[model samples]
Structures are given as C-alpha cells and as structure tokens.
Target: MEEKKSKFPKWLKISLIVIFVVGLFIGWKAYQTFMGASVTDKEEYLYINSGDSYEQVFAKIKSLDIVKHPNLFDYAAKAMDYKDIKPGRYKLTPGMNNRRLIGNLRGGYQEAVKFRFENIRLKESFAGLLGKNFEADSTAFSAILNSEEIAKQYGFTKDNFFSMFIPNTYEIYWNTSPDKMMARFHDEYTKFWNAERTEKAKALDMTTQQVSILASIVKGEALHVDEMPAIAGLYINRLRKGMLLQADPTVIFANNDFEIRRVLNRHLTIDNPYNTYRYKGLPPGPIMMPSIAAIDAVLNYQHHNYIYMCAKDDFSGYHAFATNVAEHQVNARKFQKALTDRNIMK
Candidate 1:
C-alpha cells in the first residue's frame, strides 16, 4: 500500500505547520495558567466574607499583593469555572498554584478553627473570645448573648443562660452565624450530658445547672486537679446540712472583683444573690465557665466528713480541710498570720 501523498500546494502546507505550532503554544500556556506556581511564598490567610462578589474576592486577593499572580487568576477562574467562592478563612500556603488554591475555595474547604475557652467568668469575656476566633466580632456575639429571647430559645433564663456553653476544644468554621454558634454550643452541651451523667445528677438530687454552679465553686477554690473532688465533697456536705456555703470565691464573685486575694469582712457584706456567704444555698448561677474536670469532680465527689476549707499558709495553691469549727479556726488563724507576715492585708 502506497503512503498518502502530501498536498500539492506549498503555501497550504506552510500555513498548516504554523497553525499546529500556535496550537501547541496555546496548550502549553493553558497548562501553566492552571498548574504553575502562581502564589507568593508567604504564610498568610485569605478572608472571604459572606455574600462577597467575585470582583470583591479578586480585589481582596490583589490587596494581599499575593502571587506571581497579578492577572493569572482571572484566566484560571474562567478556565476552571470557579464561580461562587465560599466565605471563610482560607490559609494561603507558602507556594500554591491557581488550580489547588481555587479548587479549595470552590469546594469550601476552609480550615476549621480550634475554638476553646477556660476560666471565662462573664458573657462579655466569652463573647470577646469568640470574636477573636470568628468572623463575627464581640459586639455581634454580645448582642445575641445579652438577648433574653435568645437565651429562652436555648431553654435558659437570662440570669442562668451562661451555663449552656461548656468549656472544651471545638472544631468550628470561622464564618458560622451568631445564632448558629449558640446552637452549636448547645449541641455540645447536650452531647456532654449523656445518660450516665444524667443518672449521676439524679443520684445526687441536683440539676445539671446546679452541678455546674458547684463545679465553678470547686474550680474556684481548688488550684490543683487532685483537690477538686475533696472540695466538691465539702460543698456538698454543706448543702446537705443546710449550712451557709460561705465560699470566698462567691464573695469575690459577688463583688465582681477578680483582683481580691483576701476575702475581708466588708467584701462578704455585699448584697448580691451570688454571695454564698450571705445566701444559704448554691449561687443562682456559675461564677465562671467551669472545666469538664471540675464538673466531673462534683459528679463523683469524694464522700467525707469535712465541711471547711482554708488555704495553706505557705502561699501554695493547696488548702487545709477541717471537719469542725475549732479546727477550721486554727487553720484560718495560721493562714491569716501568713497573710499578715506577707503584708497581704485588706
């Protein structure tokens, strides 16, 4: 069989060769447009706000001065058809290509923030912490938290509404709405209180809210993890015996002064529901966002005869426990003398 003959016209052959070369060049350019390294070698994050237009996102990318990519993403976006950019905090790696970067945005594959809180004593502080880790600011969160309607929506009153947020590390998106954020916390709180935990709360004849309140006190008094159960037990004993809680932390909380190291007589005289020194039962709410360990400590409090706690005289975080007024007075005297020697007078 004879091979096919070339076209007779020389000009036609030359034109065909030129077209083939141009097509190859175009293909190579397209490949580099999508796959070549375009972003700058910098550790930064790109924040895409909700409801942002494509133009706004493009402008935001440019504002970062990001890329070897001054004008390339337009072509990349068109070629890859990456419209509807998802809102989030997207991490820009050291050196990323347009395809990898835009693909992540298109799929809404944003980094989940590690949200957490500890020793959070007020709604203001909690809101502030959320503001730091989310697209929503403190004001937005505070508005939601301060709303009595929102609190009721979560099955809590405004006064005790803060108990819905449990302290733990949570994985959440940065752009979650304020209401959704509350829902998420509520979900976590519910999951944390399982059947076993509910049974334990019933066994002790205490509500979960009451447990959280006592946990906050236990957390306030005990500096070391080992002492949590003992302190919890002492408080439980007081509650069972109908004695005044007289917790120094509650006195500090009633004064709304976290700076008070020594609970003076004047401080205890504050007229507040949170003042366990004046009130005969548990405080109306938790004085702080208690830790999980603290909560569990109350659930599994050590059974004992102790009903009093006085901090040790050595400026150590540890405390001395006593079962009687006389013993407590002796411990209190030693701690008071140590405080006086150290000039910690109120």
Candidate 2:
C-alpha cells in the first residue's frame, strides 16, 4: 500500500489557531467579571473611627451595606497582613471594590462629625460632648478635673481646673477620648494666656483663678456681652479700694440654684466661700463657664473710678457706671421701678 501524501490546507490550520486564541480571551474575560462582581455590589457610608478593631470594622461596613460578605472583608484584611491599622471615620461609597475599600480602611480614612463645645461647667461638659458618641462618664470626668494626678501634666494642680476652661466652640473628633479632649482644651487655654494677658493680670493683682472668677461674675451679672466690660471694670474699681466684690451671681452659685430671681438681704447672710457679696475679694473659684470675651474683658479691664453699676433700662442694653453710691442708688431705683412695673421683680 502506497502511503498517500497528506495534503493539509493552510487556511484550515490558521482557522484552528484563531479559535484557540479567541477561547482563551473569553475565559479570561469571564474570570475578570466574576472577580469584579465579588467587590462591586454594595454602597455604604461608614466610619472606622479610632480604637475600632477588625471585627468592629467589619460590623460597621456590614451596617453600611457596602460589603455583602463580612467574611470576605475579614479574609482580605488578614491576607493583606495588616495588624493594628490606623483607624478613622470614612465615607464609604456605593459599589466600591473590596480591594479599594480595604485600602481606604487601612489608610485611616475618616469622616469627621463637627462636635461643638458649648456652655460647659469645666470638664464635665467636655466629657458629655465627646462621650455622647463614645464611652464617657461625667462623674469620672469630674473626678479627673478635680484630681491632681492627671492635671500635673499641664503644670497646674487640680485647684486650677475650673479656671483653665474658657467656653468656646471647639471642633473635635466624634470619638475623641475624654483625656485627649481635655488636653486639647488645656492647649487652647495655654495659648490664650499670652504675655500681654499675664502682664495685665499681674498689674491688676489678679491671678488666673481671680481673672476667671471675675469673668464668671461678669458672665452671670451681664445678660449680654456688651455689658461685660462695664461690669468687669466696676468690680475692678471696687477691688482697688477696700470694698467687697458684691456680685449677685456668687450667691446663686453658693445656693446651687439659679432660682431666687432676686438676691435679698437674707441671701447675703448665708455663709459660703463663693459668696463674693459677703467676702472681701473674688470668689474662691469660678461660678460658671466664662466666655473668651469675658476673659479678655477682665485682662484688659477699663480703668475707671466707677465703684457701682446698675442696669439702666434705656433700651440701649447698658449699665450706668457710677463713682458714688448715691448716684448708683438713684439709677438702682429707676431700674427697680422698671422691674416692678414689668412684673420682673417677683
């Protein structure tokens, strides 16, 4: 049998090669699609804040509905070999791929909530603001404020905590710890105490506590910021002589009740260290949170011989500053009439 010489068509062989290449391409495309689907299915907004663990982070992502499979995030995170990732609040987006989301989570991408500080009574308010979103106890915070142990780091004793806080709107992380938040406040107060402020306090023979005490009085007595400086100067002038700083706010602080719309003669007789109407100098400590304006007013207090001030209902929102008691009484009587007529002097 003669072996027939095989005649192969060149186009047919080329066609087979083309089919193999196309098949390979299709398989690779299908694999890519599967991988993509594993990542891009969920939309979420989440915050991986400080002190969050891997499990906690996974839970948050799941809550955001960004990742359908928490186990996949866990596996990917571990495979990436990240331990103790720096955590921050993050705004997760819809259909974010898993790898990219993991990268963001590990990079400490955070979404910050604006937590503003308001009328706080020393450290308790700080704790309340921060603790509202985190673990914070007001009583424990007050203990730290009054504790010499933690305050030593700021170069002051516990006795100075109340004076150190100046009421202002502060921006802080929603999850900031109580201690860290307090430190931030300490820094703010320290920055406010410039050389000029210190020199001014010294010139007035007032310590930081004394200034804060005066500011608190100004805060309580004056209903508006426009009247703070005048009241501050009134107290300062009284201090220059041997007169008592007879501020009504001190009595309220002593009583622990802002009730008693009027501080009567009997209220002054009650013995309390904070009763400035009875004592000869500033109160032992601040009675309330003082705004920065009040603090500034005391530091740069106006120089005057005015020993008394009474709210003058001239509709100008100002008090009549007087050098003598007789003029003060006349103004006081006029104010008394306004209060009685308005039924404000209950």
Best by lDDT: 1
How far is 212's C-alpha from truth in model 2 (Å)? 2.2
lDDT of 1 by residue, 77-120 (tens): 87788788799988888668889989988999999888878889
Candidate 1 minimal-lDDT segment of 10 residues: 36-45
TM-score of each: 0.91, 0.76
Q: Measured by C-alpha RMSD in angstroms, how accurate is candidate 1?
A: 3.8
Q: Name the lDDT of candidate 1.
A: 0.89
lDDT of 2 at 272: 93
Which residue runs does candidate 2 get wrong by more than 4 Å?
1-52, 64-87, 92-97, 111-115, 121-123, 133-139, 152-159, 169-176, 314-317
Top candidate by TM-score:
1
Q: Rate the local accuracy (lDDT) of all candidates.
A: 0.89, 0.72
Where model 1 places Cα greater than 4 Å from the true spot, the runs are 1-28
